[model samples]
Target chain A: MSEDKNDSFLSRLKAAERRSGLKTEDDTKESADDKDGQSLATLALRAGTEMISALIVGVCIGWGLDKWLHTRAIFLIIFALLGGGAGVLNVWRLVKPPPV
Target chain B: MAGGSSIDVLGQFELHSVFGGLGDALHFSQSPVYMMLAVVLVLAFLYFGMRPAAVVPGRFQAAAEVCYEFIRNMAIDTIGPEGASFFPFIFTLFFFILAGNYLGLLPFSYTFTSHIAVTFALAMMVFVLTVVVSLKVQGIRFFAHFMPAGASLALAPLLIPIEILSFLSRPVSLSIRLFANMVAGHVMFEIFASFVIMLAGFGVVGDVFAIGPIAINVALVALELLVGVLQAYVFAILTCIYLREAVAH
Candidate 1:
């Protein structure tokens, strides 16, 4: 009885695997490669958006602070530059290869 | 048709209260109704799909298992060993956004995710979670992350603010990306669909031209399907990435 159940389970696993259309080792590798390519695209997309958003956030913060402090453009200019730098830093960290 | 019959593309986004008196009192609209529907659909899919849970596994069980494994692998692959703890959160986020996107594609349904308010709220939740996790896991050391390991002290004045700004922007970027993608896709779909209707009003010759917009609309549907999945994947993976950073030594 135990042997029969084990056999049935094995057969079902194989059937399900086959039905999923990922039959061969080569197909699995191809899919992995495709995922890697997609990951790269995802990284690129994240990098650009991250940079711009950071810059915008910085400018907003700076402008708000300047307005409250009644300190004209000083905070705005400083924060905008800082924001740009931060944006670059974000992109750098995002795209940099993981440390071995 | 008169020249005044221009495509009211943006008008589709307008909100109106639903459910009669209750809707009016609560100021609720179809957006919330569709949101609830999306939630119910997702719950039903998971519950029905996994109901059998057979050793041999039927089709619905298999689909449920596949979804589970896909998200499990994603969390583990992106977040390392600690990924298991956050699996449920990531899975829920992915499926919720995905269900919302697909539900909106149905006629007369609203896409809540397309709204900046909804997406921003979701993004802020993830952002707050990341911050809380980082603080809990790393204590005061979380602040150290703002300064690059090798940066000079002389540049501290400039570097610190910039790093802080970038750190602050994660939620904004995440929210905008999802919201913009959903809005753009739905607007294009509405435009092309309206074009088909407009052209068809002109009779035979116009009906022939309508086929062009129809074909484009079909292709756009296929593209939107791919995009819905892609955006969900991106959102989930990014969450994992942020969580990974939070928990990292």
Candidate 2:
């Protein structure tokens, strides 16, 4: 019974894909590469990476500027902390479910 | 709308004098006016882009659709089936910020996004939503996010603070990412633009010499455009990830 059911389901899927004409790896790749196409999890991970990068850079930039202007690490540490806090908050936000 | 404004972000670009605040204070920033203009521009673009309904979509409609689908897919892919709902917010954010960045690139326009305060606000919104959603879905379990998996209980004290700190830094990171990128790019362009103008101001030889900065400015503009869209995408996707952790954990 299970074998028969599986076969029937596969048959329906094939029939539908057939109407679409093309069924190749290339088509799959094309859809995957669609500009607006990306998985939420993939995006989430990427966002996480970007968040880290942005925070680190912001702090470093502040520090560099402070040094250049002879303000020492004052601005650097301050901006770094602020940026770091924001990063964590953003991560926490990712935990929330978005409204439908 | 901005070209004739009574001193706005546009005016800042033109180096016209800004309004004095209460008691002889000069407000120099054009971030606000141009920011509003950017919002209007985004709405107008979306209106025209999506106005016509066609079975075979036009380029504008298709472009709009692509933006919609991209965010939708990003949400679904990151946060599982549970994340499908947040598509609208993510999509709006992506477009709004993207539009703001792009518009700032226009001649004589001030970039609101170059400011930390503006970028920080946007990031804070995302952070707030992350907390709200996580709490709603996971309730108290949201706190458990910092409890490392399979770690020894003895190490919990040291690890928890780091985890918590890491967690709290998201908005700061998110906002600064956009703010830094925009500011740096704009500054470079501004500097180059000044060079071109100053050089050309020198007359014939300066006109011939203006090509260098102009070329660099064009390249930087292209790069800025790419960064704007990418940063928007990055923000939305990060939002999804936090949501996923909330729901899944």
Candidate 3:
């Protein structure tokens, strides 16, 4: 009779946990760890692409402006330098920790 | 696939008119067709999954709810309460790319995301939306962001252009990342698949060696599955982040 009561109590607790959609502390931590690993990979990928894309955008704009103005590589040179700076800035923004 | 003795790896990306004359006349390509198919598939999945909305929730209903809640939580958490207003857009973007990525993994299917044109279009849309939202939310103050706070006025000329370039690079980076990742994965698949085919030509010993490439291809498929979902998640979360900045005081 005591064993039967214990089983019923355990079942009731399980049912309440399910109803509340609560996870054990371990479950939440494990999932968070997994997500952190994935996001790290994503951050690495974003850094390289972000840098290159910024440079590309800068070069393209510079080339277009030079062509329109007949500046003979002046705009291109200026833009390329600016674009390179922007690329570095982009990478910096990506890797820097968020402000508190 | 191996065309004669040479591997035509890039042949898979070529666009061709489907449905014979009708498609040709309409200038309809496989990219848009697959996009439509992806849309239809997502809608049908949601419709059927939710139609039997039992109180207890069946397996299909559970899966649909999980998807909904996942995007809902992502948006709300990333963008605050204003995210609810943008939930539909993020959900649609996430699922659309997710569907496109997974669908492309199937044999004889085109991965539209592999195209820079398609990804750029999507990225531009997100970029424009964020800009518009910022302009609306912050008024003329939106231009102030081009000049970083505490920056000296003497360096504004050089810094302003660099800032603008970095800002413009958002869509470029967004599009290129997705496009490049998809293209690289598919190209690797094609190369490995061709290796298996090429190796099979030398009879029994060749067939035995072909297993090496086949194994790699199998592993690649698993990796691609992860890549597909991860890329979708990254895209959606980045959108949320951008929107958060846009709406912030």
* Candidate number achieving the greatest TM-score relative to the actual structure: 3
Cα-based lDDT for every prediction: 0.88, 0.72, 0.94
TM-score of chain A of each: 0.67, 0.47, 0.63
lDDT comparing candidate 1 with the true structure: 0.88
Q: Would you list the rank order by DockQ, best first?
A: 3, 1, 2
Clashing pairs in 1: none
B153-213: candidate 2 lDDT, tens digit per residue: 9988755755665666667667877777777787677677777766866899999999998
> Please, what are the lDDT tens digits per residue for candidate 1 over residues B179-236?
8788889899888888888897899999999999899999999988987888888889
Give candidate 3's whole-model lDDT: 0.94
- Estimate how well candidate 2 is docked, as a DockQ score: 0.11
Cα error, candidate 3, residue B197 (Å): 1.0
For model 3, which pairs clash? none
Off by over 4 Å in 2: A1-100, B1-30, B201-205
How displaced is residue A85 in candidate 2, in Å?
Answer: 13
State the displacement of the C-alpha of residue B21, model 2, in Å, after optimal TM-score superposition.
Answer: 11
Candidate 1 ranges with C-alpha deviation above 4 Å: A1-45, A97-100, B1-5, B201-203
Q: Residue A8 of model 3: what lDDT?
A: 100
